[model samples]
Target chain A: MSDTLRPNSSDDNQGAQPLYVPIKRRSFFMYAGATAGATALLLTGCKDDDDSSIDAKTTVDVGVGDVGVLNYAYALEQLEAAFYAEVLKGGYFTGLAPAAAERQIFADIALHEQIHADFFKTALAGNAIKALTPNFSAINFGDRTSVLTSARAFEDLGVAAYNGAGRFITDPKFLVVAGKIVSVEARHAAIIRDLITPNSFVANDVIDFSTTSATARQERSKLPAEVLAVANTFLAESSKVSAKSLV
Target chain B: MKLLSLLDRLSTADAPAAAAPRRDLLHRLGQAGARAAVAALPLAAALPAQAAPTDTTLDAILLLLKLEDMLVALYTQALASPALAGAAQAAVRPDFERMLRHQQGHAQFYRTTLLTAGLTPPAAPRFDFSGRRNNAGNPELFPNVLNDYNAFLQLAQQLEDASASIYLNQVAAFATDRQLRDVVLRTQLVEARHASHVRTLRRTATASVAVKSWPSNADVVPSPAVVVPSPAGASTPPVSIYSFEANEVQLVSATTAVPFLAVLTGATAVQFVALSEAFDEPLPTAQANALLNIFG
Candidate 1:
C-alpha cells in the first residue's frame, strides 16, 4: 500500500521544469507595477528565453513559491465550485424533494465551495489566476452515483492537495488560513463518502491503515502534480492547470 | 491553576539532563516573547512584567499527545460501555472502532515524534469522561456520557471539533520543521473527518439536537447544565469547545476582514450562517487546556 502511495519520482521530475515560466513573469510585472529600469531590462532578457521553447497556451503553470501553492488551491476550488453548481441544476437534484437531506447537503456544499473559490480570488487579488473553464462532459449529473462519485473524488483530492501543499507555503498566515479551509474540505469528503456508502468516511483508500505498522493510520496526501493529473481531466484543454513549479 | 500546573509537569517532566543550554532556551523564549509582545501590544502596559515560558515545539507535541491520549481513552471506554451495546448502536460500532484506531495511531505518532527528537513524552492521564475530574465528590458535567448514546455522541462531537481546532492552533508553531508541519496538517484533517462523522451521527440520530456536518451558528450550544466553580470559588461558565467557531469575520491582517457578508450576498441570514460555517476558528492553547482539564 505504501509503495503505491509513494509519489512517482519520474512524474515529479517532469514537473520540476517550469512549463509556464511566462505566467510567473506576467504576474510579477502586474504585481510589481513599474520596476526600476535596470531590473526591467534584466527581467525582459530572461523572459524572452523562457518564451522561446514553451507555448504558454498549451499549459497553465500555477507559478512558484507561495503563489503557486495558492493558485494550485484556487484551481481545485474552481473545479469543485463549478462541479457543485452543475450538480444543483442537474436532474438528480431537481428530481429530489425540495426538503430532502440530499438536496440541502448539495446546496450547503455548493455555497461552501463558492465561498472558497471567491475567497482565494479576493485573497490573491492581482496575483490570482484567471478562472479556468470546467469540462464536466465525463460527469452524468442526472445520475446520483455519477455526481456523488465525482464529488467524493474532488473533495478527497482537495483535502490531499492542501495537506501536501502546506510545507510549500512560506507565509505562516497563509498556512494558517489553509489549515482552516482544509479541514472543511475534509469534513465535506467524509460526509460525501458517508452519503455514498455508510461508514466509509475513514476508509483505507484515503487513509493509511496498513497492518504491518500499528500506527499507520495517517491520512494520505498527494503532491500538487499528482492532484493536477486527475483535476485536469475535469478541466477544459485550454483551461487545464499545471503545478510544474510546485514540485 | 491546576490545569497550568499539570501542563507545567507535562512540559518539563521528561527533560533530559543534557538539555539545551540555558542560553539556547532563553533565545527561543526571546523569540516567543517578541511574538507575544506584538500580539499583546494593546495590553502590554497592563500585563505583568514577568513573562511566562512560551510553548516550544516540544510543548506543542506534548500538548497534542495529551489531547490524543484523552480521546483514545474516551473512545475506548465508550466502546466498552453497555449503553452502546444495543442494536441501534450496533450499526455505528464500526465507526467508533475506526475512530479509536486512528486516535491511537495519532497518539503513537506524537509519542514517536517526541522520542525521535530525544524527548520522552509523559505518560497518559487517567481520563474521566463524566467531567468530574475523577473525583466522586465533584459535580458531573457530563452525567450520561458513558450511559446514554445521545449524551455520548454530543460529547464526542465537541471533543472531535476541539481536537481539530487545537491542531490548527499548533500548526503554525511548527514552521521551523516543514516535514513536521505537514504531518500535523495531515493528522489535523483526519481529526476534521472524525468531527464531521460524529456531527453527522448526531444530526441523523436526533433531530432535536440541531447540527450540521460542519460547525455552524445554527447548531445547538452543547453546554453543561451546571456551571462549574473556578478554583477562586466564582461560578465559571461551562467550557465550550465551539466557543469561537461562530465567528463570521476572518482577518487577513489585523484590521481587515475577509468581508464575506458583503461579497457573498443573498439572503442575509443564509449568508451569515455560511460565512461562519465556512471556516473553523482556532482555539487558544490556554482555552484548549481548560477544556481538556474538564475531563481530567
Candidate 2:
C-alpha cells in the first residue's frame, strides 16, 4: 500500500498522481503461509477495530507456501466476483449514451467484470470470497459524469490491484494465470477511459519504455487497504464494519 | 457442409502445426474453457499450474485465440487504412490475415478439443472491429471504429501490447508445456514487432509517437507537440492503462519479468520490478488513474 502513497484519505482518494504522493513498495516477504497470513489479515479485519489487537480465531489454516498465497488470492477473487455481480445486477448507468462506441465499450466492460467475478468463483470454488455484498454508496450512479469518473477510478484500481499483488504468487503456473487476468482487467480500464475520452488510454505518466533512464513504466495503482476501503464505502454498513484487508 | 467447409478453410490456412494427435489434444482442451477461461482474474498473480503439458492444452489454444484476435484486429485496421501505401500492405496483408487465420485454427482446435473431451466450445461473438454498430442515428453512437482510424489504431496498439506483455511473461511461467510456451513466446515477439511497426506508422501519418502514447496525462486533448516515441530512450514507458498474466502458466513466459497485468494484478513483492528507470516509484491503478484525472 505504501508503494505509492495517497495524498487524501484512502476513502476520499479520487485522482491523486504518483508525483504528489510517494508510496513505498513493500519488498520484503518472509516465508509464511499465504493462507494463514491472509486469515490473520482478514481476522484482523473481522475483529473489532484495533491498531494493537491479537486474538485467535479459526482462521483458514494453510501451510507457508505458494499454495497458501494462491488460496489468499482465491479468497479475494471471491470478494471481487461477488462485488461486480451486484453492481451489474441492474446494469451500469448509460453515461455516454450519445457515444455508441462508449456505450458498447461499457457493456463489454460489464460483461468483463462479470466474467472476472465468475472466474474467481470457479477458481476458488469453496475458498472464494463468501458471496459477500459490496458497498458502492459513495458512487453516484445516477450522475453519469460522476459514475464514469468513479468507474475510471475503479477500473484503474482493479488493474493496479493485480500489479501490486503479482509478485506474491511464487508458483510459475499461478503467476501465469494472474497475468492473463491482469491484461483483461487492464483492457477494461483502457476501454473505460477511452469511453470518457478517446485516445486517452495509457498516458505518459503510466507508460515508461525506457531502460537506461528512470521513470519508464511507472503509472499508478491502489493498495489493498485502500481498495478495500473504497470497496467498503460502496458496500452495505454491515459489510464495512466487517470489511477486512484483501491484500 | 458449411461447418465442414469452415473447418477446411481453417485447416488450410493454419501455419504448419505439429503431430496430429498431440495438436488435436491441445486444441480440444483449449476449446473447453472458452469464455470461462478469462472470466475472472486477480490483479497480479493469476497464473495457475495448467502450464504443465498435461492440462495446458486448453491454455495454449486460448493464448493462440487471444493473440489471433489481437493480430486480426490490428491488421484489419492497418490494411484497411487508405494512408498505408502499397508495398507495406502487399507485404503485411498476408501475414496479418495469416494471423487471423491462425486464430481461426486455434479456435477450431479448441472446438475439436472440447468435442474429444465430450464438451462444447463456448459461443464466440462476431467481433465489431469498428468499435461501432454502424447506427449513426442511434442516440448513443460510438465512433465508426472502421472510419475513425485514430481510435482503431489506439485500440490496436493496446491489444498488441497486451499480447506482447503476456507472451513475454509466459516465457518463465509455463513449466511442463515448454514447447507450447515457446510457441506463445514466438507469437509474443511477433506482436511486439507488430507494435513497433504500428508505432512507426502512427509517427509517419499523424502525430509523433509521443502524441500517440496513450493514457496521456492531460485533461484537454493534447497538442501534436506532445511528441511520443521520441528516440526510444527519451522517455520511460508509462504503465499500461490495462494489464493481464495468462497461463494456467497461461501467461507462462521466458523471463522472470512477467506480463504487465500479471505483474500488476497478482504481482508478488519479489516480482515487483520498477516499471520505469526514471520514476523509482511503482504506482498502482488507483494512484495512476488519480494522477491522470487530475490532469484531465
- What are the per-model numbers of colliding residue pairs? 0, 137
Tens digits of per-residue lDDT for model 2, A157-224: 66555544444444554555554455445545554564566444554333333322222223344445
Q: Identify the candidate with maximal DockQ.
A: 1
B35-138: candidate 1 lDDT, tens digit per residue: 45334332122222111224555567778899999999998999999657777789889999999999988888877765544445689999999977888999
TM-score of predicted chain B, candidate 1 = 0.78
Model number 2 iRMSD: 14.4
> What are the per-model DockQ values?
0.38, 0.02
In candidate 1, what are the lDDT values of residues A165-226, reduced to their tens digit?
88789876788788888889999999999999988998999998863352278789889979
The runs of at least 3 residues in candidate 2 whose Cα sits more than 4 Å from the true structure, single-residue gaps closed, are A1-99, A208-215, A218-223, A240-247, B1-162, B165-296
Question: Pick by lDDT: which candidate is best?
Answer: 1
CAPRI accuracy category, model 2: incorrect
Query: What CAPRI grade goes to candidate 1?
Result: acceptable
Per-model chain B TM-scores are 0.78, 0.45
